[model samples]
Target: MLSYTGGFVLLAALLHASWNAMLHGNRDRFLSMTWMSIAMAAVSSVAVIALPLPADAAWPCIVASGLVHIVYNVSLVRSYKRGDLAQAYPIARGSSPMLVTLGAALFAHEAIGPLHAFGIVLISGGIMALALQGRHVSRSSALAAFVTGVTIAVYTVIDGIGVRASNGQALAYTAWMFMFYWLMPLLFVTMRGLPALWAPLRDAPMAIGSSVVGGLVSIAAYGIVIWAMQSGAMGAVSALRETSVVFAALIGRVFLRETVSAKRWLACVVVAAGAVCLGM
Candidate 1:
């Protein structure tokens, strides 16, 4: 299981970047996210029907993490409203890994190897530098991004425990978690009215298709990481998942045609070096 953690997190990283790119591409970030969540809810509703119910012990974690995710998603949309994808994405992701890692050590009795610790530092440093570079982000955007990071850390830790308490029903817990998490976004979208809600998709079937694909990609990514948590160290898994920041930069450059400076490339190199250290 440890040996596969690298591959699992790598896959999660790529998928995470892809879905975030899709969210960034939309004209209305929050609505786009809501639609994505709706798609996730649809799929998850079906999944929960097939899976066994999780133990009573797992419900608290599921409920708590769902609330945290709603906050995270709101912060994400707000951050991106005032910041570039490259800047906001890194800032949102940068601090989370370390927070999760330290929390795991202190509260969950998880141990990190010296090498893994070094790698986490490297990854965090690179992403933070990337986040703080190349833009005049508003103070509010920075705060939103910082809050997003905190939520990411919080949910990561919560889910780590939640999935563990699932009593052979971790996947069911995940399905339920998605269903619960969708409620906040659905409410947000509904508040915007029915016509406004359907307008984006009414014109673009391709957008609908892409959003569905993005939602699925995101679910698969988290599914892999969540499953990995059962047998791998939570801190390490969280740090490794932040490799998505590097992929985010690449996504910004290619898909969005955003400029990639020498600094960004250097950050990517640092991220690669950190991944190597993580693997060792």
Candidate 2:
């Protein structure tokens, strides 16, 4: 079951990286993110109707996670705006596992075996290696990315506990969480008025299509991660999920045409070794 969960999370990591790459490649990331949220909210709205509601006990988690997710999204956009995907993404994603491990131990009482601890350390170290191998990233971008990672850790722990408290209603919890959290982005876009919202769509119709696709991919990726946490340790699952940094590095090189150093490729190998340790 642990191996199965690891594989599923690896898939989620790929999807997560793909969506972030799409967002990073866009001309107007904030606008694209707004549209992506609108798409997620639309799909989640339907799911919320079809599924049973999450337990009342889970409501607090959902609300808190929702607010943190807003911070995550905002910081992510700022991070991407300030730095290359390879640089910002690794710092943002790589910093989270250790934090999640600590948070899980403190808040959720999750025990970390020696192997899990080693894997988490390796993954985190390798990810930081990928980011720090090149010193081109601005301090501001690194800071924003680190803030994004902090939010990721906080929400991962929150949702991990919340899902367990949901009486096996993981899907319901996920649906409701997405529905609730994305509304903030939707509200932000709306407040900007119709013209501002429509400008991206009118100027670049392709942005709408990409945003819709990115939104679906994003929803699927996170939904899978949340579901996996229902059975897996939050820290282990988080460390495994952040293998997305490796994929993000590759995506940045291939799609975004960013320069990737040979040392960064070595970092990818280190990350892969860590993933193997976790899978074991």
Candidate 3:
């Protein structure tokens, strides 16, 4: 069941990349994400009402994770705006597993086996190899990309722990988390970017559709992953779920017409192999 669920999780990853590709292709990236966040909140809020809430202690972690994720979203859009998608995306994503693995060791007290360490190194290296184009990426974009990666790692590990603390109701935990998750972004938009918000909201139907699809895809992806974890191993589930990076790279190359150099394809293969090893 774990292995089968892991495969389903990979489909979830593909869905994740699909929506992200949609957002990346859009003209109004930030606005699309904001709309998506708003829609996601509504959808997840309904789920939260239908499902059981997470344990009380998990609430704090969910709130904190949402705050970290808000920062991540801001940094991610800024990074994408300032840099190429192929370059910024991988860097931001590649840096996360290392942080999550470390957190797993220190906090979860999970034994870091040699295979897991090697898998992390391979995944990180592969992502970096794919991202480093050495042209047009400014220092600021690079910094933002790295910071986004760190935030991803923080939120992933926190969510993993929070989900575990739910006493087996991972779906409910996720629904509750998403309900609060929408609050931070809403408040940020209302408080900080009030003027910019109305204009984007008024002008674009494509933006709205992109937001809705992105939000739905994102919620579904995480829902599959949380369910997978209920019957699967965390480290394996996490690694498999992140295979979205590979799909993202391929999508960027084929759909977005970004370069898919031999080196990057090779790196993607290596990372996929590492994920397989983590599962094994």
State which candidate has the highest TM-score: 2
Q: Which stretches of candidate 2 lie over 4 Å from their true place?
A: 275-280
Of 2 and 3, the candidate ahead on TM-score is 2
Candidate 2: worst-modelled 10 consecutive residues by lDDT: 271-280
For model 1, residues 1-280, the per-residue Cα lDDT tens digits are 4666778788998899899999898777777777788888889999998999999999999999888878887888888898877777777776677778777887788877898788777877776666666657566776778788889989889999888888867689889988875685567756887676678777876776677788888888888878878767777777678778789989999999878789877876676566556545
How does residue 224 of candidate 1 score in lDDT? Answer: 81
Enumerate clash totals for all models, in the order shown: 0, 0, 0
What is candidate 3's lDDT per residue for 1-280, written digit by digit as tens?
3556767988988987787787788877777777777877888878877887777877877788777867777777778887766667666766666666677678777666888888887877776665564566577776887888888778777787887777777878777767765764566577568767666556777677777788889888877877776555566676776667788888899899987667767877776666655555
Candidate order (TM-score):
2, 1, 3
Residue pair clashes in candidate 2: none
User: Can you write out model 2's per-residue Cα lDDT over 99-152, one digit (the tens) per residue?
Assistant: 888899999998777876787778777866765666786667778888988999
Query: Alpha carbon lDDT of residue 253, candidate 2?
Result: 96
